[model samples]
Target: MPRPLPDDLLKLPHRRDVPFAKLTTLGVGGTCRWLFEPTTEGEVQSFVRACVREGLPYKVLGGGSNLVVLDDIEIPVLRLALPKEVIREGTRLSAPASYGHIRLSQDAAKAGLAGLEFAAGIPGTTGGALRMNAGAYGRELVDVLQTFRFLTPEGELVEKRPEPGEFRYRWSFLTGGHVALGYTVALAEGDAEAIAATVAVNMEKRGTSQPLSKRNAGCIFKNPTGSSAGRLIDQAGLKGFRIGDAEVSPEHANFLVNHGHATAAEFAELMATVREKVRAVHGVELEPEVEIWR
Candidate 1:
């Protein structure tokens, strides 16, 4: 049973029209019913507690780089924009997940810490990265995570140290009903110049392979077993495919970009068409990596 929301909570200025297009990298989506951006962990906890007490449904928002909100519906969205504060204790670093990956990597590099260089090219917050076990060049978040702090649905703060086997290519058990507050990462000593160089190389590769300059989610679909999604898409003749303002990126087959003035409906239609064509030709079902909201 859901409880009635307090009037004051609904009156909060943070709870106002939020354009999803501005929130996401794809630049397509309708307005949300409400939007809340908490700048501190304590405020996040408080906001979560209030929602729980009122039995109000809420969705947690991060960098908004890999999600699609349907233009036809309205929902409450909560954004946790915690301040960046990385503290080092020996080889372990504790910091909020809202800190962008580039910032985290730069901080770690300055401290001569290795193991996070691979994340420098990932354009998302630490929380979003952790949620998807985001990885590239054979390295992942599971490799560096020591522990994490999360808020349960009941608004209780809990600490967890997930085991290695608990994570998969782009998934983990920590997906639903839990909002990541921060994480502790373990790093090893390494040559600062060497680590920086590796990061630079990876970034260059990503720039060449991905449509970073365009409005698009990183990857539309997950890679199938023993194959790459981009390869399959390219083989299926989906590269440069267009529907309205949406098109499968000519630069990267797996990415769908919004050239300009694209709508969420158009993007959805393009995705559907691509999936159907790919499935019909290759006998393979494509699973989307981007989270869709309605």
Candidate 2:
């Protein structure tokens, strides 16, 4: 049974019974019983403080690009709705956690910033990218990250440069009760035309290799050491595989696409089967890159 929510939390702007199908990129799963959207940092702090006081556990949701909800989540979920303002100081740019990731990359390119070209095609919020240390084309967010702001589990605010061991391949320390507020990236001044050209090339690569027309939660598994997850799945001959509406994309084996009306259960089964067959044939245990929530 779920515990009653605190009165303080109920006072925040929220929605009820929002379907996860509408919330995630995979477009599958049950409902999110309580979805809190805080329009300001103060409201986010208040929500965190209220949950802490009541000993309640909550989850922070970003752009929902890298998530797969398995069922109805009764606990309160926090999604930032901060003002979309990007602060530029010389070659540095900063934005709230709620700002769109792709939009930020475009903004940087327009400003003649060179470092974010690799992020031009990455989807999700800037905070979510920071949380996952998102990368592409052999570069990562940490490579350009200057500083970041986050709320501690105790609801205290802290802003500082990233430390060693705090971030790694598709992972970060901003888990458990921690919540990212914003981030600053140090970029280099470059020719706007050149920056735009690089960004365009990256986008074109993604357009050709990825299944952008289909609904998917990006890559289903992380690439194992010295091997590509997509290549491995392709070599294992799982491409075009299907169970229900969930299918391993023939275009990119690492991506699992939902052909509308896919169920969470079907996706789960498909993932398990892919893993089993890959391991049986290749002897490599694949790890999931997307965050799974129930």
| Residue-level lDDT tens digits of model 1 in 107-136 | 888888999998897777888887888888
Using all chains and alpha carbons, the TM-scores for the candidates as numbered come to: 0.93, 0.98
For model 2 the local lDDT of residue 132 reads 94
lDDT tens digits, residue span 142-256, model 2? 9999999999999999999999999998999999989999999999999999999999899999999999999999998999999999999999999999999999999999999
For residue 152, model 2's alpha carbon misses the true position, in angstroms, by 0.8
Could you give me the TM-score of model 1 versus the true structure? 0.93
Q: Assess each prediction's global lDDT (C-alpha) against the native.
A: 0.82, 0.94
Q: Which stretches in model 1 have alpha-carbon errors above 4 Å?
A: 1-5, 8-15
Which ten-residue region of model 1 has the weakest summed lDDT? 1-10
Every model: Cα RMSD to truth = 2.3, 0.8
- Top candidate by lDDT: 2
